[model samples]
Target: MWNQPYLETCCRSALHRLTLVGRPGRPDGLKDGPCLRRLEGMGLARQREDGRFEATPAGWDRHALEIVPRKSA
Candidate 1:
């Protein structure tokens, strides 16, 4: 349970959203409220001093591994 923390549907989506850069109207980043908060609590995302949200390194890795579709090898 420690290696990979569980993520809800909303949080997973938020995590994926965090990987996106320069989103229009998203000065800080994805603001999915509770989802973002949960991700932050789980160490997946962090809020910048400017009050914007961004994915942490762990969040990026998690998104890559769990969200990004893998090509069949």
Candidate 2:
């Protein structure tokens, strides 16, 4: 499981086109890439060959609750 802080830091906007992590203006920041890489290493996501980082299947599993609809009573 990804650390709460790290997971919370992940960009959640569906329309967000920025693949690079960290602050919005600075794409070449020191901590951003590494932090994103660490998440990739942990199987939370994958850095695509196209330079975009996408959440892996396991990553989806980790966030399943967010995707799954609640059962109607």
Q: Of the candidates shown, which would achieve the greatest lDDT relative to the real structure? A: 1
> Which model scores highest in TM-score?
1
Estimated TM-score for each candidate: 0.76, 0.45
lDDT of 2: 0.48
Q: lDDT tens digits, residues 1-73, model 2?
A: 7544344444333212222332232232334566556656767567666566666666555555443435779
Q: lDDT tens digits, residues 1-73, model 1?
A: 4668778888888777778752321244335778888888998888777777778888888887889967889
Where is model 1 more than 4 Å wrong at Cα?
Answer: 1-3, 22-31
How well does candidate 2 match the true structure in TM-score terms?
Answer: 0.45
> Candidate 1 at 44: error in angstroms?
0.6
Lowest-scoring 10 consecutive residues by lDDT in candidate 2? 14-23
Residue pairs in collision within model 2: none
